[model samples]
Target: MRILFRLVAAVATVLVGQTAVAEPLTLIIARAVAVPDSVSGQAMLSLKLTPDSGKAFARFTGANVGNIVDLSINGAVVTSPRIAEPIRGGEIMVSGTFKPGEVERIAERISAGDAKVEVDVKSE
Candidate 1:
């Protein structure tokens, strides 16, 4: 009986190991162009992330996955706090707020082509 229990435990462990809840997510910066429309309220830019596959319940352990998000631009960058939410398949919704003149600032950065964005993600 003890041997049987041990075998069962081993099998369970193997199965669990094979199916980790977390996976590396690719954050591709789509377009960081500036928007000067008042309706959008400034500091607005078009952006996107790719290959988003993971379970929200699982933590973002830095062990398996290295970094969280990476940002690269050819122009200015407007800093703000962005939020990502799970979408259809392998996608997430990312939005944030920026400074009043954030859009113009980003434009200048991109024009200079010396600005790149990088973000880090780790286990909670």
Candidate 2:
């Protein structure tokens, strides 16, 4: 599918310690699919970023190596994974605690181009 992913709102500010603090950086996704895990044979979400988005993600991950990022679909939080290292290849795999058939439905929604995939970077 030809998906156009971009960052709608790059950053939002919140009141913290009587000062404006930026947290929870949001990134829209381009392409996604539901697949089986190679080792465990469980359902997982595979996300592929566009070239531009790949660069952006690389920069984001590179800067925030030890931070946690939340993956969500249609405002529902899916998984919050710690950034171990910079993901320069643009491929992100999300394996969460999914109920039976949940991953399939999510994949269908994403394939139909109706679901909104988001990544929220949390500040420490």
Candidate 3:
């Protein structure tokens, strides 16, 4: 299964203009729900890590306190927010200026269990 978890955007390397530029780490996430943004009053996507994944997330966030966490959609970085506290509840709110129909697509993909573990071989 693809590893998906909330992350504090740690500085990393990216080759740009023949130079290694520091870039925000791509935060792979599991499931997110589409909703209205609370602050901006715009479109938003709320995320909640799965049970098993949440445990690991708590531990990671606990260790990496006071860092910026990034959110990505379709392999593109959308938001990078700082960790205010340890996310024990596994709930995250993602709000951004998205293109048309982007929020619906994310919700659909998650609801359809796109992030779940895939089985290549079936056993009868």
Give the candidate number with the greatest lDDT: 2
**For each candidate, what is the lDDT?**
0.42, 0.73, 0.56
Q: In candidate 2, where is summed lDDT lowest over 10 consecutive residues?
A: 8-17
Tens digits of per-residue lDDT for model 1 on 1-124?
A: 9999999999999998872334433334333466544665545554433333223212333233432332224322223222243222422222356667665676566445445543333333
- How much is the lDDT of residue 42 in candidate 2? 92
lDDT of 1: 0.42
Backbone collision count in every prediction? 9, 0, 1
Q: Write the per-residue lDDT of candidate 3 for residues 1-120, one digit (tens) a residue.
A: 223222222222222223222233223346767887667767787777677666666665565456665555555556666657767876667677788788778777766666432101
Off by over 4 Å in 3: 1-31, 115-124
lDDT for 85 (candidate 2): 90
Where does model 2 exceed 4 Å of error? 1-30
Q: Which ten residues in a row have the lowest lDDT in candidate 3?
A: 115-124
lDDT per residue for candidate 2 within 21-80, as digits (tens), equals 224444445777889998999999887777777777788777667778777788888988
